[model samples]
Target: MSRELRLAEVFVELADTLVDDFDVLDLLHTLCERSVELLRADAAGLILADQHDVLQVMASTTEEARVLELFAVQNEEGPCLDCYSTGEQMANINLDEVQQRWPRFHIATAEFGYRSTHALPLRLRGQVIGVLNLFCAEHAVLSDADVKLGQALCDIATVGLLHERVVRQGEVLAEQLQGALNSRVLLEQAKGIQSERAGIGVDEAFTLMRAYARRTNQPLRTVAEAVIDGSIAADELKRPR
Candidate 1:
């Protein structure tokens, strides 16, 4: 798929996961995975600042990315760190050319086998959370469109993460989301129970449960919880009169 299409699909997938309680790490992990295919980079990584302003590797496509990021941190240089510090992208950079920009980092990262690099800040409304790092074995300038696309993807992920952090609404929404996730676990258990009892497939049992929920105007999670808690009589599923 084109990067744009893949990005659209990514957002759709994320929207699907936004039910009640969502996992931030899961979404961030997805973002890093998609960036590799979307940008066609040899490797990619996500770096975020902790409470102490220390740059930590949140995710990476390869062991090399992890090592290079560590090299950057230790050397106190490299595109990702510069991008994060300036809140500006550092794109299509040849380590050999800008040897002065990050001398020690350039030497170390190139030694690790990456030739060209691009770093886009994960910025929201002027505040930078971290950077999205892309590295390629071939030394070439990243197309303007590709960099823009990278920034856009990072922006979408940043908003989604920050939304989760803020939407708790006195932490009620957070609790509700957690409850929904817990309810999903119950639904899984109920599906297994119904599958064994009715000699139906697990998927079929889920469909029946969803159909029941839709017909009764109750949420899927609520229906699942009811089934698991014995609040809904099992025999009730067979009666119409």
Candidate 2:
């Protein structure tokens, strides 16, 4: 498919998340995956603030990206943190050039083979909930158009997350985001369990769990919880055909 057509499709998919039963974790993962495909990024990671205003790695396109995002959060430094705190987009940041500005993050990015990155805030009006991060394997710059497109995606994602229904429920924004973070923890545990049981990588385990969730018409979190609680066997999850 053409890039324009694919981009339009991505927008529609994100918009569909407005439904009452939409999964926040799945939506964030989709955002990361689509950002990598449409924005010339080698990998993508999403970091969202928890109820206590702490940044947590919510989704990533690759294992390396997830590790790097976790490193950023633990070290309390990186483009994502900066972007979230300032509520401004940090685009085309050359990791090598920012060594002095982000010493530990620079080393972490280098170790991950990422030479450049961009951080766009998931913001709506005055509230900034999280950041959408893009990583590049080469020292590169994003064109103005790409930066705009990335920010637009971030905006839409933020709106979807803080849906009007959630707002009308009063103080549910924090609760909703916290619930997604909690779901991520369950997913990680389930992935580890499935990986060990199936002798597969965590990524493959996640794929199987996601496939099972869709095939069974169940929420991904529910599937993950089932796996964690020993209600679902790893062998029960088949790869999607």
Candidate 3:
């Protein structure tokens, strides 16, 4: 198949993975494989940044590629870091011509036989999330068309990842809401138990529960769950230990 058709197929496949139970690892694995195939890169890898701004190797086309990418980060040099830091596309970086720019990165990747590298930032609007790295073993310089196509793929992937994150956050928000409701339910039940056992009002019961949890260094939720489940002796509540 032609490159355009292949890329279209990849987009379709990627879209199919966006269902409710999509596997994130599988999606990233496919992205790296498709980049290698459609971009004609010798190897490709994806680096994802966490909330802490720490970049981690998320997926790669080859183990050697993965090692080289990590070396790029550890050495604090190379196109990936440069692209990420600047939130710009970096391409056709010839290691031979610019060895001085990244001595350790050039040496480490050169040992693995990669002669050229490119990195594209995965960004949405002003927020740059990560980088897509492509390496060549044959000192290849990307043509204008190659650069455009590679950047397009990276942009698509960044949009997809960002959409997935928004969906995940929605799910997390729903879960948190459910958790809060569950906690409220358990607290009510615990209050009832304490009130009946201690001949106290619900407010007094809650205050006693909170005080005990704070004194014991246990979470209020844990104490409430225990009270509701009858694991905590009712007599234990009276003594405030």
Candidate 1 — worst ten consecutive residues by lDDT sum? Answer: 172-181
lDDT of 1 by residue, 1-241 (tens): 6755867787686555454445444455467767777778888877777655667665566657767877777667888888999999988888776587888877777787888888899888897878888888888677888788778878887776556555555564334334434554576688777677777766567667766775786766677777777777666654453
In model 3, the runs with Cα more than 4 Å from the true position are: 164-241
Candidate 1 at residue 216, lDDT?
82
lDDT of each: 0.71, 0.89, 0.73
Instruction: Report the number of backbone clashes for model 1.
Output: 2
Angstrom error of the Cα, residue 131, model 2: value is 0.4
Whole-model alpha-carbon lDDT for candidate 2: 0.89
Going through the candidates in order, what is the number of backbone clashes in each?
2, 0, 0
lDDT of 3 by residue, 81-195 (tens): 9889999888889887548788888888888898888888878787787888988888888888878777776777666666656666665423432343355557668878988
Error of 2 at 164 (Å): 2.2
Q: TM-scores, in order shown?
A: 0.65, 0.95, 0.67
